[model samples]
Target: MNKTVWIVLALVAVLVIGAFSGYNSLVNMDEAINGKWSQVENQLQRRADLIPNLNATVSGYAQHEQAAIKAVADARAKLAGSQGVAAKAEANNELGGALSRLLVIAENYPNLKADQNFRQLADELAGTENRIAVARKDYNDAVQIYNSKIRTFPSNIYAGMLGFGAKEYFKAAEGAQQVPQVKF
Candidate 1:
């Protein structure tokens, strides 16, 4: 074979290898984003699952706190039915607010606070909330990495060609950064 033919073949081989590598990288990043999102969803579901038990225990002691209980239920339903990451995050924020109200109601009832089951459930919910926070952070981190990859130069070219779009970060809903007003 001519030297020119050999050089051309080598160039083509290098390009093929580089293209394959880029495509694989995009695939891995996309999968990481997807997996992180699942973790966030699982943690949210765990928090939602604990709501019923928490509400049931609190209801027996604070019958007058019906509004808070209803709010939590409504928020949980909304979170469960939410479609995308943005919608789910908004719904989850609403649920967090409702849960805060429910906890406040419990504070008014000494008996409920002292109850063993209520304490355990509250502890579990708090732990679940922590998990949700960690999961959300991890998910946002993964999204950041994936989004950066899709937006950056060389990867951006491959990402666009491969249809690897940017992933959304889990952001706080509007007014979430403000200090919540607590009234007596």
Candidate 2:
């Protein structure tokens, strides 16, 4: 009888330990997802901040390109006010298209392209875009891992009990699969 009781106690202790370990792991993964998302937001904010200066430089040389300038401004505002991953992704695509048009208009003015300030701003914007791409990839990767964990055995049970839900991925906007046509 004593041996049976000892064996039962050992099993109970093991189960308790396993439960604590699983819960801690889920919390860690959830926090990791939040950190990765913050990085994506940081990169996005960097790009948003760069837009005004870029628009100013382009406008000085291409004064007649008011429509393109306004488009970029409007897209930037939309991105700023956007709340979720999907909304931001859409706004970002709009901003990207606007920026492309603005750049093309700048191409018509050799002076704008050659200006030191414009050149520097353009390079910085390019770098920020690259950063944003990397950040988004990182965030999506985290989301994938978290989602898989919450759908798998053992962890799934803990996740459901703890109210941990799946996170959304930062997906590319529509029409992004099409190749853009460039003209000289």
Candidate 3:
């Protein structure tokens, strides 16, 4: 009777330890996912911040292309006010499309492309876009890890009990696959 009681206590201890470990792991992964997402948001904000300067510089040279300029401003505002990963991703994609059109329009104005200020701002925006891409990849990777953890066997049981749910992936916005028309 004593040996059986000891065995049962040991089993319970192992189960408790396993549950605690799983819970802690999930917490850590979730935190990592949040951190990665913040990096993505930071890069996106940087891009948004650069837009006004670019808009101003281009406006000075391409005064007639107000439509393209307005599109960028609208997209930037939408991105800034957007909430949640999916919404933000959609907004960011729209911003990306708008910016692409703006750049394409810039090609028509030789003076805008030749201006040093425009070049610098465009380079900065390009770098920020690259950073945003990297950050999004990191965020998605973290989400994958976190989702896998919560969906696995023993951890899945603990995760469900602890209320840990899978996170949504950052996906390209609708119409992103279509090439944007740049009509002059």
In candidate 3, clashing pairs total 0
lDDT of 1 by residue, 97-184 (tens): 9999899889999999999999999999999989988998998998888888778888888788788887778998789788989899
In terms of TM-score, the best-performing candidate is 3
Model 3, residue pairs in steric clash? none
Off by over 4 Å in 3: 174-184
> Per-residue lDDT tens digits of candidate 3, residues 10-121?
9999999988888888989999999999999999999999999999999999899999999999999999999999999989989999999999999999888989999999
Q: What is the TM-score of each candidate against the true structure?
A: 0.93, 0.92, 0.94
Q: How far does residue 41 in candidate 2 sit from its true spot (Å)?
A: 0.8
Off by over 4 Å in 2: 181-184
Prediction 1 global C-alpha lDDT: 0.90
Error of 2 at 24 (Å): 1.2
- Cα displacement (angstroms), candidate 3, residue 124, comes to 0.7
Number of clashes recorded per candidate: 0, 0, 0
Best by lDDT: 3
**C-alpha local distance difference test of each model:** 0.90, 0.91, 0.92
Whose TM-score is higher: candidate 2's or candidate 3's?
A: 3
Displacement of residue 125 (Cα, Å) in model 3 is: 0.9
